[model samples]
Target: MSHNINGKAAGKFAAVEQEFAKNFAERGEVGASVCVSVGGETVVDLWGGTADPATETPWERDTVSIVFSCTKAATALCAHILVDCGLLKLHAPVSEYWPEFAKNGKELTTVQMMLNHESAIPAQREPIRPGGFLDWDYMIQRMEDEEAFWEPGTRNGYHMVNFGWTVGELVRRVSGKSLGTFFRDEVASLLSAEFWIGIPDDFSQPIAPIIPFVPDPKMELSPFTKKLLTEPQSIQALSFLNNGGWTPNDPEAHKAEIGGAGGIANARGQVAMYEPLANGGSINGVTLVSAARLAEMGKVSTATQIDATLLAPTRFASGFMKSMDNRAYPGGDQMSAVLGEAAFGHVGAGGSIGFADPDHDLAFSYTMNKMGAGLLLNDRGQSLIDATYAALRA
Candidate 1:
C-alpha cells in the first residue's frame, strides 16, 4: 500500500489532503484524485498513484480517468442549456424534437422523464449487435423502435446505459449538433473545462486505465447485487450488461459519445463544469444558464422512489441526482454523497462523482483508476466529500 498521494489544499482544507492519502493507505485506492471548489474557486486539487497499475506509471497532476455515468451530468448540462435557449422544453413530448422517439408507445414521454429516468425505455428489447455501442445511430434506432418497459411516467428506473443516447439524442435533435460536439463547443470549450464527452482518437490527455475491483473473500452480494448478477433478463442487468457490459479501454471506443457512461475528465475538469452551476450559473464571465434556470434544475423531480433499474430508493432533480440521506444510493452500498438538500450531481460507477451544492456555492469531483464495487460513493471518495463539507462549515 505504499504509494505517493500528491496534491495540495488551501489553509482551511488540509483534511481533504489527508483523506486523499488515507484512500491509498486504508481503502485500496490504487490511483485517484479529489477536487473541491467553493464560490467557484478551487481549494483542493489532488492526484496520485499509478495511472496504469500494470505499467506502474505515476498518476500525474494532469492524469484523467474515464468517469462512467458521471458523464450524465455533462450530458444533462447540454440539455439544460438547450432548455435555457428555448430550443427544448422539459415537459414537452419527445415527439416535439425527435419524432422517432414517439414510436412504440412513447408518444407521451416527455424530456423531463428521460432526464429523471422515468421514460420506461430503460433497455432495448432488440438485441444490440456486437459493437453496437460504437454505432450511435444503431443504438438510438433500437431505442426508438423498442416498446416502453412501463408507461413513461409511472415508474422510476435508472436508465443505466440508454440515458446517454436517449437524452443525448434529444440534445442533438434540438441543437443540430451531436451531444459530444455540443458539449465540446458550448460547455467544455466555453468553460475551458478539460471534460470530454467522447475522447478523440488523437487526444493527448493522460487517462488512467480503470482497474476492475477484486471481490473481497468475506463479502457477500446484497439482494440487489444478487438480482443484477444472477438474473440476466432483469431490467437492471439488461439496462447495463446487455450491450456487452464492457467499458472501452481504448481511445477509439472512448471516442464514441455514449452520453450515460462515456465521459473523460480529471476531478479538476469535472469540478469546472459544476463550478458555474454552483456560482449563479456563470464562471469566468461565461453564463451557461441564468440563476432562474439553475434554481429550477435543483428542484426535486423524483424522490425516494424504488428505482426499477437499481432497485433502490433514489432521488433526482431535473437531470441531476439529489443528495438524499434516507436511501441506499444507486450502487448497492452506502448513503448518498453528503451535501446540502439543495445540492445536485451525478455519480459514475466505481466511485467517480461530480456534484454541485448551490446552497454553499460549492462544486466537487472525485475520480479514480481503481474500481470499487457498488454505485454510490465508496470510502475513498466519500472520505474526501466528508472532509470537503467539514472544511466548508469551518
Candidate 2:
C-alpha cells in the first residue's frame, strides 16, 4: 500500500517523491523519512508510515531514530573542528593530546590515523564489563589497554564501536567537553539541527523503535556477517558484536554518548547538519571549518582493497565515507555507497544515511527504523539518493 506522504517536495524533486512512495509500495519501508537540500535550499522533505507497529502510532513531523554510525560523521566533525581551531593537530601523535593513549603500542598513532580507521585497534580481544559503554571512564581505560590488531600503520580496519571512544577521547581531552556536548555547542546548535549524540533520560521525543535484522537462509550473506555468525573469535565478529551490553533499542543507549554508533536523528535533522558542509562549511554565517579543512574532510584518506572488519572494499575520507563503488566485486553490490567523487559522509548500519555532495551543492539524508539487509546503504536509501541526483540532472 502506498502510504500518504506528509511533507512536500519541490517541482523538480517530484522524482524523489515518487521513489519515496515506491519505498512503501514496491519496497518494504515500514517507517522512514528522507530530506534533501541543494544550493542551500531544502528541495524535498517527506515522511510517513507507522512509528510503532504494535501501537500503529504514525510517524510524525519530528520523530527521530538511532542513526547508528551516521553519528560517526558528527563525531568526526567535532574532531575536525578542533583541528580547524588549532586546538588539535591533524597529523600530531594522538599522544600529544591524550598521553595515556600511547599505551599498548599506540605511541605513533595520529589523530588522522584514528579518523581514517588506521589505528590498528579494531576491537578489544577481551570482554568488557556489562553496560561498560555507558561508563566513559571505563571505555577510555579500555582504549588504553586494547592491543593493536596489526602493527600500527601497516594496515587499516574499521574501528566499529571503539571509534567513538578512541576519537571522542581526543575531543574530550582537548575541548573540555564530552563528544555530544562539543557537537551540540559547535555544530548542531549552530545549525539548528535536531541531531544528538546523547539524549536526556527525560527526552520526551518519540523515537521510532528499530526493527532488528532477521537472517534468511536462502539469501547470500556477507563475509563479515557469515564470520560474525560462524567464527566467534574473528575480528569481524568482535568488531560488531563486542558491544558491552549496549543494544540499539535499549533505553540507556539513547541517553549515552556513544558517538561511533549511537546517534538520534531524522532526515530533516541530518540535512540541516550537513548543509553547512555542503556549502563550504558555513550556512547562515556559522562557519564550522575553513575551506582547507572542508577539502580535507572530503578527500579520500584511505581506500582499502579489503577492509579487515567488513571484508569488503571500502573508501574513507578522514572520518566520513567517500563514494564506495563495490559493485564489480563479488557480493559487493549491496555493500556499495554510490555518490559523487566529492561527496563525504557516513551510513548507519541500517538503511539510514546522511551526506554532503559539494560538487552538486547538495545535502541529503534518509532515516528509517525498519532496517533492510546489508551493512551499507540498502535499496530504500540508495533509491532516494539516486532520485535526488536524477532531479539534479533534470
Candidate 3:
C-alpha cells in the first residue's frame, strides 16, 4: 500500500518515499513513521503500517507511540532552556536546586551527572510497584532515602527508571512545577509538538503499548555482568522487571509521569521539537535555548567510559548519544561513517530513534508501535535513514 509523504520537501525526497513504501510491504513493521528536516525545513514525512496488533487501522501521520529513552532528549531540553534563561546551571551540584538530593553523599552530583547517566541511580534497592510511579513525592522520597549503588562520577550506568525521578526532582524544585508541566510549557508548547513527558488524559487514546522483545531465557552474560547482577541492587531491578515493572499496559502507565522513558510522540512532533537543537536551538524565531548553552549540551562528557551500564559501546554527550567513530544510527556503516561525529541524538526502546545530524543540517525522528528484536537501530529504520541521505545526495 502507498503512503503519503507530506510537505514541499517530500517532492525532493522521492528515494525516501520509495524506500518507505518498500519497507512497509517487505518488513514486519506493524506501524511507524519517519520524518526528516534539513536547515529547519522538513523534507521527508512518511508514515504507514498498522496502529494496533490486529493490523486493521493504518498508522496515520498523527498516530503517537512511546519513544522510550528518546524522551530523555526532550527532558534534557527542558533543563537546557532553564540553564539558558540563567535560572539554573549545568555544572552546579544538583543539591543546589534540590536539597534532598544531597543525601547519601550525592551532594557532589551535578546536573550534568543526571543528563549523562553518571549519577549511579538506576533504581531503588527496594523495587517500586507497577503503578506506584505515579505519585511523584513517593518516588522522589524513595530516591532521596536510598543509597547510591556506586560512587557518583566514578562510573556511568543507564539510569533506566531512576533518571526520571532524579531529573524530574530538579525540575520540580527549581521551576516549582513538575517535569511534565515544565516540559509542556517550555518545550512542547513552544514547538507545537505533541510529545509528552507525562501524557495527559485527553491524548491517552492514541498511546501505543510497548511490546517487549522476545526474552532469551538462556541469554549469556559476561562475568562482569554476572557479578553486577549478583549485587542486591541488581537483584531488585531484575525482580521489578520479572514482576512486570516495565510491562504495564494501561494508559495510566503512560500518564504516570516518568520523564526518562515514558514520553509519547509521533514522527512529526518529534522532528519539530528536536529540529531547533539541530539548528542551534532556535526554529522559526522560537529560541528555546541559547546557542552557547546548546553547544554545551552537545559537548562530549568523557567523565565515564563508553562500556558502562548499558552494555553497549555508546558514547554519550550531556543527554544525547554521540555518533563517535561508529555508525550507531541508520544509513549503514558507510553513510554513518561519512556523517561524522557532529550527529547526536537518542534511541528509544524497541525500534524508535531520533537524531540530529548537524553536518547535513538534518533532524530525523522515527517512532514505531511494533517492537523489534535488536536493542539498537533496526533494519527497517536503517533503510529509511539510508534512503533519506541518498535522496539528499541525489
Candidate 4:
C-alpha cells in the first residue's frame, strides 16, 4: 500500500517527513498526519494516507479526528489564560468561582489542585446518566454530588475524562462562556487553528471518524486492565468503562464539549495551536498568556510514583503532561511519552499527540484515525517525535 503523502518538509526536516511516510511502511499507521514548527517556523507540515479506510477516502490536508485527552491541553490553556488575565487565581479555591464545588470534601480544592490532578475528582463512582456528557448541567450536578476518592490534595490521581468538567466548568464560570466557546473566541480564533473542542451543528467540514482500539488477544493484561476487569468497583474501572454511552465516532459526541477526551484536529491544526506557547506566549499579535505565565505552563507541578487512577507513574505540569521518561521502569517504555525536558502537552488515546517544547522553541503534533495499542505514545507517534528532535539537533 504505497499511500501518497502530501505536504512540505523544509531543509533538515525533510528527513523528518521521510520518517512520517515510513510509518506506513514499517509501522501500522492506517491514516495520519504529522506537523512540526521550529523557532516559530513551520518546517514540516504533512498529511497522507486514507481518512476513512472503509470508504477509501483519501486523507486530505484538512482531515481531522478525535485527539482524545490531547484536548486537555487546550482546556487547560483556557484556564491558564484566565489566570494570566487575573480573572482567576491559581491558588484560589475552586469554590471561589463555583461554590457548589466546595462540598463533598472539596472545600479546599484550589484551581491549581484541579489542574495538577491533586484535587481527587478522578472519576464518578456511580454510573452517569445515558449520554450525560452532552448535558453540561447534568455533568456539573453529578460532579457536585460525587465524593472524593481520597483526601483531596493528599494523593495524585490522573483525572482522566472528568478533567473537562472539573477544570472546564471553572473556565465557564470565570469567563461566562462554555469551555468550547471560550477556547474558540480566545485561543483557536487567534492562531487560526482549526482545532475545535466542540463542533457546532452547522460545522460542515468532514471529520475523520475514529477507529476504535483493538488489543491483541495474545497480549497480557496490564495491572490497570486486570484490575478494571476483576474489580469493577475500583477507580480504574470507573474511570474508563463508565462513560455515559458516548462513542467517539458519533457526530453528536463531536458536537459536545467533552474537552477532556473529545477534540477534533489534524497535525497542522495542533501545531498551529501550540505555536504561540512555544514562541513566548504570543504570535501574530495573538497572545494567550505572558512569558511569565508560559513559564508556569511548562513547569512540572506534580510527580507521583503511581497515579491513583491509572496505577502508573505520572508527571503533570498543571493541566499538561511534562516530558515523561518512564523507559527504565518495567514495561514503562510502552507507556512513556518522552519530549524535550521543558516541553508540556498531552497525548490522546491510540497515540495522537501535540506538545510545545519552549526550550527548543518547537511545537509538534501527530493526528491519526487508526487506533494503536498502549496507554500513551506508541512507536508510530514517538518515532516522529524522535525524528523531529534529531532534525532539530542537526
lDDT of each: 0.85, 0.90, 0.71, 0.89
The residue pairs in collision within model 2 are none
Sorted on lDDT, highest at the top, how do the candidates line up? 2, 4, 1, 3
Expressed as tens digits, the lDDT of each residue in 251-305 for candidate 2 is: 8889999989999999999999999899998888989999889988999999899
Count backbone clashes in candidate 2.
0
Looking at candidate 1, the ten consecutive residues that score lowest on lDDT are 326-335
- Model 3 TM-score on a 0 to 1 scale: 0.87
Task: Please write out the lDDT profile of model 3 over residues 278-314, one tens digit for every residue.
Answer: 8987899888778787777777785433445544454
Candidate 1 segments whose C-alpha is farther than 4 A from its true place? 326-332
Residue 107 of candidate 3: its Cα lDDT? 68
RMSD of each: 1.8, 1.1, 4.0, 1.1
**Candidate 2 weakest ten by summed lDDT:** 325-334
Each candidate structure's TM-score, on Cα atoms with residue i matched to residue i, is 0.96, 0.98, 0.87, 0.98
Q: Give the lDDT of residue 200 in candidate 3.
A: 72
Per-candidate count of clashing residue pairs (backbone under 3 Å): 2, 0, 1, 0
Among residues 3 or more apart in sequence or in different chains, the pairs in candidate 4 whose N, CA or C atoms overlap within 3 Å are none
> How far in Å is the alpha carbon of 114 misplaced in model 2?
0.2
